[model samples]
Target: MLQKAFKRYIDSFRGFSKEIWILALITFINRTGTMVLPFLSKYMKEDLHFDYDHIGTVMVFFGLGSMFGSWIGGKLSDKMGFYKIMIFSLLTSGMLLIFVQFVTSFIGMCFAMFGIMLIADMFRPAMYVSLGAYAKPENRTRAFSLVRLAVNLGFAAGPALGGLIIMGIGYKGLFWVDGASCIISILIFATLVKEKKLSTHENHEDTEKAVVKSVFQDGPFWIFLFGSYLTALIFLQLFSTLPLYHSEWYHITEFQTGLLMSLNGLLIFFLEMPMVTFLERKQVNRLKLILWGTFLLSLSFFVLLFDNWAGILIVSIIFMTFGEMFNFPFTNSFAMSRAPKGHEGRYMALFTMSFSLAHITSAKLGLGIVSRHGYTTNWLVMGILGLLSCASILYLKRIVAQSK
Candidate 1:
């Protein structure tokens, strides 16, 4: 019985190629260096002395850059090839981070954050395109989950180490470390990855037609993107609002907060792959997973309503991580499956844009609610949003089924 279980566990990783692993490695390295964004609110509040509104505005600027970056990355990946985009995003974003260390004024910091994220987030669409290009159809969900595993593993390390590093070298150290990781990943990718050939079979008329057909034209996908946007808005609260609430309400230190945040990644690292593998073996419906995931995610936020106890926070984090495991990997696979041939990058980009939209909106909206009502209000709002997203996703499933 144990041997059979072990065999099934190994089978989850069956279809990934050397390229997929290398890409996953690059993802791990990049995410491991993900020391800056998660802690940006703390740095702004403590170091720069920015208030909640100021931080929200800055985050919105960052979101603007990210949203534009994702859209452009998607469009450009189709035209320029994903390999070139990946190499450029990594190198340029790394170099840009060094400049982030020196910004002094509010406007200057906002612009710098915008530029950094614009370059940094261009990798999303390119990475998605690369994963789709590399993995087989039957194995695509597991492939995405594997890459997310690499990400979660890196995230597991990044914050815990970041907490220690911040204690020693201050916020500038975060920028330096983040920049170095991007550069290191560049070297690994450039050394190992051969440039992928773009589709060359199209005639002039077909090529012209392809250029005109955009990912936005798909109505059901638009609904899906909206639902994804709502879910992302709630999930991103972990980064945007939760840390601030911990510090202000619980008087938690930055290091402790980092440790708490790490719990989300750690839980996903251990459980996501195994859970996905088991669900696959059981042949679970993909749409059902997403719906349930959204519902659970909302419940995670609602868990925080019992905020009198520290233990409740831990429970909420665990629930949220389980929700993420259900939502993200399967959603990515579903998006890839929905892509019209030859436009995968654009489809992936629009989907990625959903998160970017969340980034832009969540911080500002969350901080506004916290400023006006209270932290509890923010959690309640997020829970409501999640419930709405569940409905949207259910509708999306119906649309997807009809199209099929």
Candidate 2:
């Protein structure tokens, strides 16, 4: 029985192209080094002596940079191609990250954060478009799952290691490691992945059927993007406010908090690929799955209302992780499918922009509520937002059905 299970796990990884594997490798390398984000809020609050409002403002800058970076990345990918964009984004962002540790003042940190993220996040849309270029239509969703596996695997490692790094050398060490990782990951990509024009043949039929000339004209997609924004807004709390909660409320140490956060990535690493493969084989309705995932996300926050037991944190993360596994890969696949061949970068940019916008709102709104009301109030608001996200997606499902 164990042998059969292992074989199934192995089989789930089969049939991907060489480029897909290389992409996954670079993602893993990059993400494993990305120890800064999970710890950024804590660092600002504890090290720099910033208040919640200041931290929120800095994060707003971060998100703004991400939003603009995603937009330009998509446009430039369409013009200059994903390869050059990927190199420039990684290389420039790495240097900026290393420099960020020096900026101790609130205003300096804000501008530095913005600059780092603006260059950094350009990789997102370009990477999504690259998947469309590289992966086969039949296995595209699974391919997305594979890259997510790399990301989660990196997440699993990054925080745990980051915790130790903080314990040993302080937060300054995180900047060096994060910066080096970006450079290394890009160098690896530059070495292995050769530049190529997007193949028009694979998506020609879908492109032909596309009636909307501009991404703005795609009404249902806008609805979907809004739903995505809500989901992202709710999920991003894990990085921003939740870490503070772990320290303040639960009295968890940074190392312990890192371990708890690592659980999220570990769960996705072990379960997501096989589960996604099974779902693909079953050919389930993507929107239905997304709705269920959003509902789960709502429950994850609501579970925190039972704050009597520290164990509830574990249960809450489990719920969030499963919800993430269900929502994100399918979201990528659906968004990619909506793009006409030539305009892939634009469609993907808008899709990625939803998350960037959410990142902006998530920090400010969550921190504001925590400052004014409390953590419990914040969780309740997020739970309500998750429900609204579900409704938006359901409405999108109906719109799509009517369009068909």
Candidate 3:
């Protein structure tokens, strides 16, 4: 029985195409070097001695670059193709990582980080477009999950190793490793992944003849985007504020913090795909799953108020990871579902832009809250926002159903 169960688990991967698997592999490789961003806040505070306000401001710049990158990357992917955009992004961004090591001044670092993120984030929308190109409609959600699984697997390795690397070689090791990882992924993609072809039908016989609908005109998508944005605002705290919180409140070392961060990725890596597979088999409502996920994600922050930092953190991260599992891939799948064949890049760009916007708001707003009102108030506000996000998802469901 155990043997059969394990075989079934292994067989689950057979659903997606080989191209999708390659995409997953590329993501895994790139994310394995994802040591830099997760620890950027800590580096800023400790190594550079930046205040909360300056750190938040730097993050806002990161978000601005991300927002611009996604918008332009999506547009470029639609026009130029995913392979070109992704290859360019990976190569250029990798070079920028090494440059980031030298910037010591606050203004210089902020500008450097922005440039790095701008080039780096272009990969996201292009990756989303590639997933749509590769996966069949029925396999779309799982395809996204598979890519996310690769991401989590890489993340599982990155921070845990990064903590040790920081101790041994210092932060410069993070930059070099991250840069090398990006170059490695680029080589893999350039050699292994074939560009998806554009048929005459999708292009309307030529690029100029293709009719692209404005994302703003799609009412249900607008609602969906807003709901995604709200959830992102709450979820993004994990990157921006949570690390600092862990260091300060728990008095933990960088390795301990890496372990805490890795816990989220580890849980999602082992369980999310299987859990999502079960949910799909049960015919769970996608919108309902997103709603519950957002709620749980929000509640995870509030769990900090309960007093036992160690145990509560473990429990909270579990809930947060589950919430991430439900909302993230499905949300991307939904955006893909809504796009007309030729408009995949634009639709995905707009959808990704929501999270970019959230990165901006969450950092500036969350850090500001902590600086002024305290972490307790920040958690309370996030919990309330999460409930509001749930309501938005329900309303979004109604809008989608009405449109159908």
Candidate 4:
């Protein structure tokens, strides 16, 4: 059955020709470096002995830079071309990682992560837009799903070994590995991938411009983005809050926390593509699955609140992972299908902003939830909001139709 589903996913990509495979390989390599993320904080905190507030400060700059970079990256891809933008971003991301290896102070570290994230996020939308442009309509969803699965495959192994690298090789070793991965990814993309972006500047020859006139000006796009960002706000807490709750509240080991994240990635690695292919073929409504997926994702937080139990937390995370499988890939595919005819770059750029904004607030929002209402209430509120995102997606659909 697993092999059968895998074949369906590949078959779905029948008309993609060769461009899509090259992009997938590039994505897989770039993401492999990122998989080291699950433990970077723990290393900084326990080994370097940084305080919680300091870590938050570091994340703030990272978030701010990412938002700015992602917006610019999307437009640049639309104007200049995906391949060019990716080459620049990939090369920069690796250099930034090497820079981060040398930074020690809070401000310096913040700048490093921020710089890398800004560059990394810029290439993200172009990649998404390129996939849609490179593949056939029927294959688009599967292509996104396939790409997601490839990302998780790297993520699954990267973190598990990251823990060992932190122990045996030290934190600097992990950074070096990540830097090398980025270099490799950039080289592969520069050599293998080839996708041109649309020209943004009509009068300026071929210079890139914003995908559309003030992309944020679109009412539906912003609304959908906000709704999605809200989910990311809650979802991101898993990294920070989950460990604290598990270690202090649930008494789960530090090692176990890392293991749990690997488990999440593992589930995503094996199941994501198959689930996407099957779900795409089913008669079920797309919006409904998105809502339910968000709902399940929020439920992962709920288990932490229940007597701070590890078992429940594990199960809840599984639920959230399942939900992620349902929402994220399909959301990209659906957004692409609904994008305005001549504004693919603008469409993907604005869409990517939702998650960027969320990453900015995700940690602080999660911490705020715990401080004000306690973990349980915050998780419950987030879960309810996840279901509501369904309503928002549906509402956006109506808005799009009205515009049409």
Best by TM-score: 2
Better of 2 and 4 by TM-score: 2
Q: For residues 1-404, write the lDDT of model 1, one tens digit per residue.
A: 98976786677777677888899899999999988877888999999999978887888888888988888888788888888889999999998987787886789989998888787778899889887677665566788999988887888788878888899989889989999999999899999978765433322211112122657677777888888899999998987789898889888898887777778767776677778878866867787999999998999999999988877878888888889999998889777666666787788889898999887788778988999999999999999999999999999778766655
Give Cα distance to truth, residue 347, candidate 3, Å: 1.5
- Give the count of colliding residue pairs in each prediction: 0, 0, 0, 2
Angstrom error of the Cα, residue 376, model 1: value is 3.6
Worst 10 residues of 2 by lDDT: 201-210
Point out the worst 10-residue segment of candidate 3 by lDDT.
Answer: 202-211
| True lDDT of residue 213, candidate 1 | 64
TM-score of 2: 0.90
Candidate 2 lDDT, 188-228, residue by residue in tens: 98998888777555642232124688888888888899999
Candidate 4: RMSD to truth: 5.1
- Give the Cα error of residue 218 in candidate 4, in Å: 2.6
Give all TM-scores, in the order shown. Answer: 0.88, 0.90, 0.88, 0.84
Query: What is the descending lDDT order?
Result: 2, 1, 3, 4
Predicted candidate 3 versus true structure: per-residue lDDT over 32-109, tens digit per residue: 898887789899999999998898789888988998899888989988998899999999999889778889889998
Between candidates 1 and 4, the one scoring higher on lDDT is 1
**Per-residue lDDT tens digits of candidate 4, residues 1-404?**
97877787565555554877877877777777775577667766976678988977877777777887777887787677777777888788887786677777777778877888888788888788778667665566778877887787777667767778877978888888887888898797777755554323222211112234555566666676766777676777776666777776678787888788878888887677667667766745555677677777766655556673457867877987888888888678656654554556667776777777887776677778888877777677777667667678778657655654
